[model samples]
Target chain A: MDYLVTHSPALIVALPLLAAFAIPLISRLGPRVRAVLCLAVLGLVAALVAILAVDVHAVGIRLYTFGATAPEMALPGGYMVPVRIMFEVDGMSIFMGIVITTVAVASLIYSLQFLNGQTGQARFYSLMMLLYVGMMGLAFTGDMFNMFVFLEIASIAGTGLAAYRTNMADAVEGGFKYIVISAVSALMVLLAIGILYAQYNVLSIAALAHYMQYTTLDMMALGLLAGAFVMKLAGVPLHMWAPDTYTVAPAGTTPMILAASYTSMYALYRITFTLYGGHIDTAAIGWIVIIVGVLSMFVGVMMAVHQTDIKRMMAYHAISQGGYMLLGVGVGLAVIADPVALANYGRDAMNGGIFHIINHVFYKAMLFMTAEAIFFRVGTRDTNKMGGLARNMKWTAIFYAIGALAISGIPPFNGFASKLLIYQTVLSFNPVLSVIAMFVSLVTLASFAKVFYSAFTGPEMPGYKEVREVPKSMLIGMGILAACIILFGIFPGLIVDTIVAPATEALINQAPYINAVMGAAP
Target chain B: MSALSYEAYAVWVPIVWVAALVVIGVIVLAWRNRGQKSYKKGTAQTDIFLSGIKVPPEEQRHVKAENVYWGFFEALKGFYSVLMRPHTGVVNDYILWFVALVAVAILILVLGA
Candidate 1:
C-alpha cells in the first residue's frame, strides 16, 4: 500500500498506455473479455488517481522521477541541473486527475453499450485509453518537451476518435478540420517549447521557473504557448472546429474529447500562473485573457441560440461555459500583484474557476451523453426531427434535465455552486464583467430551455413512439456524472475545501511548485 | 453545512436552497391535489379547445425547434449577421483566424514587454 501510494503517479499514466497497446491482443479472447479488460484498466486508473489525490492532500506535492535511482530524486547526484523526466503530483494536477478519471470511467462504461454493434471496437477502446494517458501525462509531467509530446498524443488520438465514423462525409470533414486546427496549435506549442529550451538549456518546468528572467524571448514563448493552448481550449474565433467535430464524434468519446479540451485549459493555467509567475505584466496579460473570455461568452451563446443541431448547439455552449472559467482566473491573474485585492476577491475568483472545472466537466459530459442518447434512439442530430422523447426515454429525460439545470446554474445544482462563486467574486472585481457573465448564464438557460422543449417535451412524435429508454450501461455512465453533479452541488463547501482550495493555491503561488522540484530559491 | 466562500462577500448554501425548493414543491403539490377530481377522462371535457378554431393534429400543434426563438432571432438579426460572417465553415478561414490571433498575441506581448 505504501509503495502504491508513493509510485501512483508514474503507474497511473503507464497503466493506461500499456493497456491501450495490450487491448487489441486481449480482444481475441472475446468481446466480453475485452470489455472486462477495458473496465478493469480504467477502474484501476481511477483508483490510482484517488489514492494519489489522498496522498497529495496529506503530504503536499508528490514527485516521482522516471530514471532516477530514487523515484523522488529530481536531481540525481546533487547535480545543479535536473535532467530526468519527473512527475510532479501537485494539487492542481490531481484536481485534473479526478476529472480525467471520472470522465474516463463513465465514458468507457458508456462506450461499451454505445458501440456495441460497431466495428473497430478494439481500436476505439485503445484510442480512448491513449487519450486518457495523454491527458494524465500532460497534467503531471514537469518537462516542457514532454508536455508537447503528450499534447500531440492527445491530438492524434482525439482526431482518430473524432473521425471514427468514416461512413459519413461530415464526420470525415469534421475530423479533417479538427486535425488541421490541432496540428497548427500543436506546432505553435512545439515552437514555444523550442524557444524556451534554446534559452534556458533545460526542459524541466520547475528548473526553468527558478532560472526565469522574463526576457523578451520568454515573453515570446509565453505568447506562443498561450495562443496555442487557448486555441486548443476552443476559445472563440479558433472555436470553429468544435461544433463540427463534436456534432459527429461517436457517442461516449465526445466527453473524453471535451476533457482533452479542459486538459488544454489546464495547460493554459499552468503557463500563466506557474511558468510565468510574477515576471510578466499581470494586468496586460490578465486583460488579454479577460477579453478573450468575454468574446467567447457572448459569441459562443450567440452562435448557440441559432443552432438547430442539438450537438452543435451544445458545442457552442461548451465554448461559452469555458469563458466563465477564463473570466474567473483572469480576474485572479489581474489582481495577483495587489495583495489587498488578491485577498478580497482574487482568491475567490481563482477558487471559483478551479472548482468550476470539475463541475463543468461532470454536467457538461453528461449533457453530451444525453445529446448522444437522443441521436442514438431517433437516428437524428437535428432537433427539428425530435420531440416528446421524455415519454419513452424517461431516465434519459431526467438525466438530461439534471444536466441542463446544473449547467444553466439553476439553484441547488453544481453549476450554480461554481457560478455563484465566480459571479460574486467577479462582481467584487468589476461589475460589468459580472453583469456580462450573468447575462451569459441567462442566455445559457434560455438556450438549453429551447433544446429541452424541442428534444424532450411537447407532443410525442409518431416516428419516435417506439423509442425505449437507453440501455442500463449508458444510464449508469450518465448516472455517475449526475450523481457527482448533485453531490458536488449539495456539498459545495466540502469539495471546495478539499480539492478546489488546494488547486487554487497551487496555481497562484509558484514558490511551492518550484521548491518541490528545485530546492528553496536562494 | 459550511458555505462555499472564502470571504464575507456572499454565501451560497445550496442545501438550504434545495430544502426550500422541496418544501415549496410539496406545498404546491398539496395545493394542486385539492382541485376538483370529478372531470371525465377521454370525453369532450378533455378535448382540445382552441377558441372555436379547429384544433390541429397533435404533432402539427407542436412547435419545431428552429422556430422556438423566432422573435429573438429577428430582433438580433444585425448582430447575428456580424457574428455569422466569420463562421464561414471553411478550413482556411479557420486557420486564418488562428494565425490572426497568434499575430495579435505576439504583438501585444512584444509591445507590452
Candidate 2:
C-alpha cells in the first residue's frame, strides 16, 4: 500500500500502457475476456486517480523522478544541470486525472455494448488504453519535451480511433483531417520545445520557469505553444474539424475525444500560469485569449443553430462551452496584476472556469451518449428525420432532457452554477463580456430546445413507432454522468472547497511548484 | 467573498418561476371556464387553427422541425448568412482557417512584445 501510494503517479500512467500492449494477446481468449480486461484496467486507473486526489489534498505536491535515486535528485554528482524526467502530481493534475479517468471508465463501459460484435475489438481497446496513457502522462509530466511526446502519443491514438470506422468515407475523411491538423500543431509544439531547449539547455518546465527572461525566442515559443494548443482545443476559426470529427466518430468515443481536447486546453492553462508566470504581459495575453474566446462563443453557437445533424450541432456547442472557460480564465489573467481585482473577482472567474471543465465533462458526455442512443435506435443522426423517440425510449428521453437542461444553464444543474459564477465575475471585470456570455447561453438554450422538440417530441413518426429502447448497459453509462451532473449542481460549494480551490491555488502560487522540483528555487 | 455561494444568489428563482406559471395557468383556466357548461371532444373548439383552410388528416398531423423557429431565423437572416457561408465542410478550408489564426496569434504576440 505504501509503495503503491508513493509511486502511484508513474504507475497510474504505466499500468494502462502495459495493459494496452497486452490487449491484443488477451483478445485470443474471446471478446468477453477482452472487454472485462479493458474495463478492469480503466476501473483501476480511476481508483488510483481518486486515491491520488485524496492524497494530494491531504499532503502537498508529489514529485516522482525516473532514473534517479530520489524524486528531487534531478542533477547528477558535480553536474550543475538537471536531465532526469519527473512527474509532478499537483492539485490541478490530480483534478484533471479524476476527470479523465471518470470519463474513461464510463465511456469504456458504454462501449462494451455500444461497440459489441464490431470487428477490430482488440485494436479498439488497445487504442483506447493508449489514449488514456497519453492524457495521463500529459497531465502529470513536469518536463516540456515529455509533454510533447505524450501529446503525440495521444494525437496518434486519437487519430486512429477517429478513423476506426473505415467503411464510411466521411469517417475516413474526418480522421484524415484530424490527423493532419493534429500533426501540424504537434510539430509546432515540438518546434517551440526545441526553441526553448536551444536557449535554456533545459527541458524541465520548472527549470525553464526559474530562468525565464521573456526574451525574443521565449516570446516566439510562447506564441507557437499557445497557437498550437488553442488550435488543438478547437477554438473557432480552428474549430471546423470538430463538427466533422464528432459527427463520425463512434458514439462511445466522442466523449473521450472531448476529454482529449480538454487536455490540450489544460496544457494552455498550465503553460500560461505556471511556465510563464509573472514573466509575460498578462494584459496582452489575456486580451488575446478573451478575443479568441468571444469569437468561439459567438461563432460556435451561431453556427450550431443552423445545423440539422445532432452530433454536428453538439460539436459546435462543445466549441461554444469551451469559450466560457477561456473567457472566465482570460478575465482572471487580465486582472492578475491587480491584487484588488484578483481578490474581488478574478479568483471567482478562475474557479468558474476550472469548475466548468469538470461540469462539462459530465453533462456533455451525457449529451453525446444520448445522441448515440438515438443513433443506435434510429440509425441516423439527422434531426430532420428524427421524431417522437421519447415515446419509446423513456430513460433515454429523461436522460437527454436532463442533459439538455443542464447544458443550457438552467438552474439546479451544474452548468448554471459555473456559468453564474463566470457571469458575475466577468460582469465585474467588464459588463460587455458578461452580456455576451449571457447572450451565448440564451442561444445555447434555443438551439437545444430545437433539438428536443425535433428529436424527442411531436407525434410518433411513421417508422419510429416500432423502435425499442437502447440496451441496459448504455443507459447505465449515461446514468453515471447524469448523476454526476445533478450531484455537482446541488453541491457546487463542496466541490469547489475540496478540489477546485486547491487546484486554483496551485495555479496561482507558482513558487511552490518550482520549489518542489528545483529544491527551493534559489 | 465565497466563490461557491450559489444559494446566496437566489437559487430558487427557477422553481419560483415554474410555480408562478402553474398558478397563472390554473387561474386562466378557471376564468375562461366560468360561462361554459360543458365541452365536446375533438370538435371545433379542439381543432387546431390552420388559417381556416381545410386540410387532410395526414397533412394536419405533420409538423416540420426546421419551421419551429421561423420567426427567429427570419430576424437573424443577415447574421446567419455570414455565419453559414464559412462552414464549407472542406478539409483544406479548415486547415486554412487554422493557419490564418496561427498567423494572427504570432502577429499579436510579437507586437505585444
Residue range A9-42, candidate 1, lDDT tens digits: 9999999999999999998998899999999988
- lDDT (10s digit) by residue, model 2, range B71-96: 98899999888887898888888778
Model 1 clashing residue pairs (backbone): none
Query: What lDDT is obtained when candidate 2 is compared to the true structure?
Result: 0.86
RMSD, one per candidate, in order: 1.7, 3.0
Cα error, candidate 2, residue A208 (Å): 0.8
Please report the TM-score between candidate 1 and the true structure. 0.98
Instruction: Give the per-residue lDDT of model 2 (tens digit) for A1-522.
Output: 767777789889998999999999999999889888888878787877888888899988988889888664666565655678889889889888988998988888888888876899899989999999999999999999999999999888888888999998988988898888889999999999999999999999888888888887888888889889998899987888898887788878888889999999989998999999999889888887888899999999998888888988999999999999899889989888898898888988989988999998889888999998999989999898888888899999999889888888986788987898999999999999999999999999999999898888877888887899989889889999998988887777778778987888888778877888677434
Candidate that would win on DockQ: 1
RMSD of candidate 2 to true structure, Å: 3.0
- DockQ for each model: 0.59, 0.40
lDDT of 1 by residue, B1-113 (tens): 11335334344556667888999999999999998788888889889888999999998878899999899999989988998888999999988988888888888888878
* Candidate 1: Cα lDDT at A183: 91
